[model samples]
Target: MTFLRDLLGIPGASSDPAALAAAARDRSGADPDGLPLAVVRAEDIDGVRETLRLAHAHHVPVVPRGAGTGLAGGALAGTGAVVLDVSAMDRIVEIDPVDELAVVEPGVLTATLDAAAAEHGLRYAPDPASAAISTIGGNIATNAGGMRCVKYGVTREAVLGLDVVLADGTLVSTGRRTVKGVSGLDLTALFVGSEGTLGVIVGASLRLRALPERTLTAAAGYDDVASAARACGDLARARRDPAMLELLDGLTLDVIDRAQGTDHGRRSRALVIAQADGPAADAEIAAIAEVLGKEASWVEQGVDAASSDALLAARRLALPSIERFGKALIEDICVPRSRLADAFAAVEEIAAEHRVAIYSFAHAGDGNLHPIIGYSGEARPAGVQRAADAIFRLALDLGGTVTGEHGVGLLKRDWLAREVGPDVLGLHASVKAALDPRGILNPGKAL
Candidate 1:
């Protein structure tokens, strides 16, 4: 592998041991046994093409990485591989307001593209929590869903087309600039969630929507997790479509209050935040307030726009706030909307049984719960694993998936077969085999 980098002559490629080690892990927090031989920060399409071509020739494994913000260890370099870093390819090729599309390079941050689109009275709807730091390429790789997903959609929904570099350095483009096209197999969608195991995404053409003219938000406090969840179910049944609806358990609220030194301390066991966007915001929020009022202990009807933004900002800070209290392991599981209440109940039982401090929050509108266990106690890993296993099993039993948005990277690989069954898993393997016969493109990830 020493001569691999030299033979490629790829610009900005590095063999620094520290860089190699850094490239080995992502936000997944799991350290690999070994690191890649080199890290190549590709500046453009040519750089990516050459890097992959040389690695393909040598049969050296290639791991494509963006901002390394993935919660799954999809980008972790376990064996002797070459890490192709594309963060330097940050560029916005075009933003066509008439066509409602934004052409961008792989490294452009999600928030950056949104900001650029904002100038044209347009917005990219997939607002992941890590929007400020996570690159578009990474979001596409994971098919990431976020707060707005309940109303808008996920990364794959926003993606209209993609320019991908295959394992053998073959550049193939899929999808089209037009919104409605059924030309062939949706290869663009296929690559969107493949987590780089199929091909490396070099460019993306994203569909955009006009920015909402008005926004309204509502909040409610529940006496128990079940009540809060029922309120979410009520909102789901209502005709109104809110841009985002979130939940924060009492403990998570306490952590946020402690971290920020605020006066949010209340007796409610859970807090529900809901928002609606567009010209009919007032009516939609009025409807949401009605549903929540039925089950909430106390309700704040139609908070001011500024207050709404503040409430959302606070919701976004849930993970970091809890991390300040203790060692936190965040689990992402989404159950059926009706089973959300049961799911929370199970997590509570598991936490009490295992004697672990578990705090939770969710995109309750979508039945996605992030149960964060904060523990700084004895044998933390064992306790965390047990609690996680219980929570995930409960989700699966409720007819939910192991991952809602996060890909089946190393962290969730163990349970994927069980969720999808052997036949479905075999199909995934077949697809992987057809696209990546060498198994060099992000080996040991996704499928």
Candidate 2:
């Protein structure tokens, strides 16, 4: 504690009990292993470097945190660790419309950057549901994906370069501002999704896109989630590339209806919401509606902007709506688009077999599903653990991943080996060893 205070002499340093307790945990709902030694609210790159230097010399573990909105416990601090809170370093350095790029500090909010880009007739493309609150550093750390991922890809795609502070407090810059660069081993991509294990992210150069000329939204009602998933597959088969596509299951719809006082469940057992942007948005949405109409019980297309936002709000409310029931164990699994219906069927089967209620929603265009299991207890039930394991195995069986965008934090660490095999797992350890030989950076998380 004394060491941390001395290292960061800035006013941002704190050892308050309340602040330490709050800094120890993230949104994952998992209890921290123990309280952190201290919380250092870094306001600039020098503060981060100094903190890391002290921690490295003392062999104290350091946890790099952004907005603390991670769902995978990646930011949770453990015993004897130093929590380096970087959210105070929020600054947008530059926005170059001509080059379609933006240079920003890691602590800048995702939505704030997009809003700034919009001022220049451009926009940042990667938008997670928590874009309004989550920091860019956190998104880049997890390589986050959202509904727009179906078209624009994930955070890794938008990042052009990074300024990282290694475990030994060495500052190194990777990548270039130009669109094309193969100057080296693409270390920027490696650090983007490293979950703060290899190094601490201080700054980033991000790619931006021009705002769409036109946009359209469409919604379809189906008798079941399987039907809606099949419709998504049909859209893919027909080569209809929507900017955003989301799906909600019957149980999820019921929860949302109860919370929002809407009759979505009464209207249909499942719902599919989609959006198309750019010059061909109208034609793309028309084709999407035609394909979904084939199996949908009802179809609504070309909705007004306000109505479209209202419809999209339902999808965003899925997680919080279910959380009201109890402690929700949110699971992120993705399968091949062709096997989406099969995956949903397997989820239903698992829920029934385990005698647990599982509400699900999805980024259907990309085949990433969120299966939420709720429980009312101080500790997670054994059945819930079994059900989660079954879901991960099911994803592997269908040629998918245990996690699509959420990185493997403590919750998914054990299953990572099952997904990547022994050889690749060894390679991951080697990389971690090379980057952080002392193993003091965010230990016991990610790999």
Best by lDDT: 2
TM-score of 1: 0.97
Clashing pairs for model 1 are none
Cα deviation of 268 in candidate 1 (Å)?
Answer: 1.6
Predict model 1's lDDT versus the native: 0.87
What TM-score would you give candidate 2 relative to the actual structure?
A: 0.97
What is the per-residue lDDT of model 2 for residues 322-386, given as tens digits with 9 covering 90 to 100?
88778888889999989999999999999999989899889999999999998887798889989
TM-score of each: 0.97, 0.97
Query: Which parts of model 1 are misplaced by more than 4 Å?
Result: 1-8, 377-380
Stretch of 10 with least lDDT, candidate 2: 2-11
Model 2, runs deviating above 4 Å: 1-5, 8-11
Candidate 1, residues 1-447, lDDT tens digits: the string is: 445746447887887888888888998777887877889999899899888888887788888999999887888886678899999999999999999999999999999999999999999999888999999999999999999999898899999999999998899999999999999899998999999999999999999999998888888888887899888988877755878999888888888888988645465778899999998898888888899989888887555777777766668778888887767776789998888888888888999999888898899888889888887744457878899888878888999988888778888887887899899999999998898788789887777
